[model samples]
Target: MRNWLKIVIFLSICLPLSGTADEKSGDHSKYVRHVEQGFSAIFRGDNQTAISEFETALAIEPDHSEILHYLGMAYAQEQFWNKAADSYQRSLALMPDNIEALYSLGVVYFKLDKWADAVPVLEQVVELSPHHARGQEMLGKTLLKLRRYGDAAPALMEALTLKPQAAGTYQELGTAYLNLKEYTKAIENFQKALAFGPGRYAEPHYGLGMAYLRLGDREKSRAEMQIYQQLQKEFAEYERLARLTRAEPNNLEAWSGLASLLMSQKNYPEAVQVFQRCIELAPNNANFHHGLSRTFMALNYPKHAAEAAEKAVQLMPDQSILYNTLGSAYAMQGKRREALVTFQKAIELDSEQPYYHLNVSKLYQSFGNQKLAQEHYRAYEHLLSEQKAKQK
Candidate 1:
């Protein structure tokens, strides 16, 4: 479920702590000091300390909506979800139109997987904060989870208009369209989500496959399903290896396996972190350097990618795939000559490899060398055919 419901627990220390006129209670100065300490504790990630301080503030100003809201935030940070919900409810009772209390309550309901309970609260949030992108997104996601496809679509569309590159919103919107049998719209949204390179999200591809199938495009459907299945397997492997890494932080193999799977899943940021762990564990490992290079390339950090690729090449000069990756990195950096030379080396080392021949062919075509391009293209085609024949 695309992290759509994460309620940040940053309490507003700057909020004026003037006791509400409705709450004819304790010393306003004490209430303000307690609130300040509570928010400071929340900022420090000390949820228990924050909870204690907020409780003291609540004791001083029993009917204070702001204090109640911050108390709920502290409870939420501690995963005392039911307590958080109750506090938010109390705050909302005091300030019926409070957007923060409504949104946080909706998020707490979502964290509890109470989709039914989340809808109305989230709807109120969006109604109150019409321009709030995340409020719209959460409403859409909640509706999607409830399989309210028709209602989900418009909310998701609004969210997309607010933040076009929100991949999760796109994924949920695609699923909504797919369920509603709007194949073309489903396909378009699914393709958009995938274009953002969310390889960890297998469901969007599955939705694409279903949409294509509904459109009577069996070949395209099957292709999408294949990708979905591969990503599913890789995601599972990543989770498994992640557990192993956590259990054995010093385990180089575990880190390497996790990094490789993350790379395959297109989680380039996490992949880079895990690959960096592997490098720290075994600095001279060519495979780790290669993985780092690939992840950097995926992240569009071409300079970093080229540097990592160079290290991989130096570590394993005989590896054709390393040279091919290096070539691609060079190409990404617009070093056409170096790219061509590296691609040629890869082809020389692996003459029958279709990818190497295809890369060289594309490079030749880019340079307007029609004859060389045609020759390499034919070679690529021949190799691909031979491989397919062998598979048959």
Candidate 2:
């Protein structure tokens, strides 16, 4: 399942407005100002500022459903689940059919692991908005947590229909089938999940392995189990790194390790956040900026990558790797001349770096300079061979 917090944050930001305070009311100007400020804070990820602004808004009009809902979102962002739930409950009390409030409340419950409490709220969400895919998905996950396998299967199946490529839902549905002793269906759903997520999802492989074991297919089960175990090891390492960062928020090494692991997992969004946090702790750290640049590149935000890479280069102008990263970002933005110049600077700084030579070679190739391309390519090959030989 997707992290409940992430789901709540996304929904809070994207869901259509249920309603707003009456602009024609006497206190409308004051209320709107505070509400606007609250939303601005929310967008900036300043939960404290958001909470304060929303409280001010509520003081003006305590019965406003929309402001209460916004307050819930701010509280949820800060992981203050109890406060979030209270705000959502208040919002729903004023506007009973507020689907977003209902869903957010259910998500808060799910995050709190109050699975039974989550069920009816999520059930109401799906009932009110039958086409709400995330609502169905959350309801199914809540049911799965409660071990209501038969109920979970249908809800998850509906979610899969709405979101055909949700690998997590497929994995959960496979689990439902597995526990129901429908081994073939379990294997089928798990295989579909693996096909969609490949190496990123381990749980499906474990489910598949269990299904195969039930069917007495030892070889297939062994292969799936091996993959599952390997992925589990990698996931364990990631979790350990994540825990270290949480335990020592000011520890540069811990944050760096977690950011690197997130990048390797291709989770560029979270990696960007981690890199930003690292930068916050050590603003002058060029490596954090370089990592942020790489993450932005992975996210296909070439302009952002260029900006971060430029910061990295400014902080550590002598580093060949920073120049290389800047060059790559420029190349992504179609700044061919800038890319070539930056790449050449990288080579000048460290002539023996084979990857730098390879980057220049590719750029030259793109510019139809075959002679220079081949020259740089030959240098890359020779340097790479020398490095390998030295290692051997």
Candidate 3:
């Protein structure tokens, strides 16, 4: 009877314990698998897939803080601010001391324009990790947004100490000083910002203009304000073009205009990217390839320029401008004979284009063919004179 009781106890305790352990192990494995897949999708910029995988992982491990944080990142990437905030909040609830979650929550609040809400969370972030430059910077900006200039100044100063070359931070700090009626300090910070970004950013110029105006330096203020106005106009146009592209991704005209604008701004790298995107949208369009070639040339990537220009010529053989661009690329690459041939082709396609004749003339000059060079040069001069007469 005792032996029977012992067997019963063993079966009841050991069998159930073994089954529970196996079930837990299986659940853990499944949760990890889903989490891994979620991260992989996020790395590939597939936020929807990442969100789905993270949601599945969350279902399996409902209280996992790290998983919640990752889900928040995917949501943030999709610009679902509220959803991202909720995920971060939930993650922080499970791990209240998590500095990353706190910082992320603060950033989301800032994005949502919840300046009041962002303050305490960012405060917590800095409190937990005093050396976190980005957290300090965001906190300072949030404080500035709230118009707490006094509090913002020191925070921003600390941020600057951590990251001395931050142009935006300098701009924000200058604004803080301007609000505090410290015109000289504001000017100094604004100048520092301009030193970093120059013509690429507008806010520092505007702030400098304001500070100069306060100091009764009307001449300097006017100059600075004029530049600010021009920069603002360019920024507005950029925003308009950006919105158009977002609204109509396949609009070749919009893409081309944006790429052209970037090139005009001397943002060669960004122009290259936009031109590449234009090519992706319309692979057979020679203009996009030509634009890319020009951008690559501006960047001094002669090999890349040659390749892109070659593609453009192949796509639109009859286009004289494509041949001219290819010739320019070949010239840059020291392929003098190829460049001469290509430039001659451009002139043959459109004899009225003075630049084509000019290019061929230069190539002939390089080859010591003085007679041909002078002949082409005269043709270039004649065509240019005709163009000028038409303009008149």
User: Each prediction's TM-score against the native?
Assistant: 0.65, 0.67, 0.82
Model 1 RMSD to the real structure?
A: 12.9
Ranking by lDDT: 3, 2, 1
TM-score of candidate 1 to 2 decimals: 0.65
Instruction: List candidate 3 stretches off by more than 4 Å.
Output: 273-286, 311-321, 344-392
TM-score winner among the candidates?
3
| Cα misplacement distance, residue 150 of candidate 3 (Å) | 1.6
Better of 1 and 3 by lDDT: 3
Select the stronger candidate by TM-score from 2 and 3. Answer: 3
Q: Could you tell me the lDDT of residue 303 within candidate 3?
A: 96
Q: How many Å off is the CA of 206 in candidate 2?
A: 2.5
Whole-model lDDT values for every prediction? 0.89, 0.93, 0.94
Task: Give the poorly placed runs of model 2, Cα more than 4 Å off.
Answer: 1-135, 194-199, 219-223, 226-240, 243-247, 277-286, 301-319, 385-392
Instruction: Summarize candidate 1's per-residue lDDT along 103-185 as a digit string, tens digits.
Output: 99999999899999999999989898998788899999899889899999999999999998988888889989899999899
Per-residue lDDT over 79-197 for candidate 3, one digit per residue giving the tens place of the 0 to 100 score: 99999999999999999999999999999999999999999999998899998899999999999999999999999999999999998899999999999999999999999999986
Q: In lDDT terms, how accurate is model 1?
A: 0.89
Which residue pairs of candidate 2 clash?
none
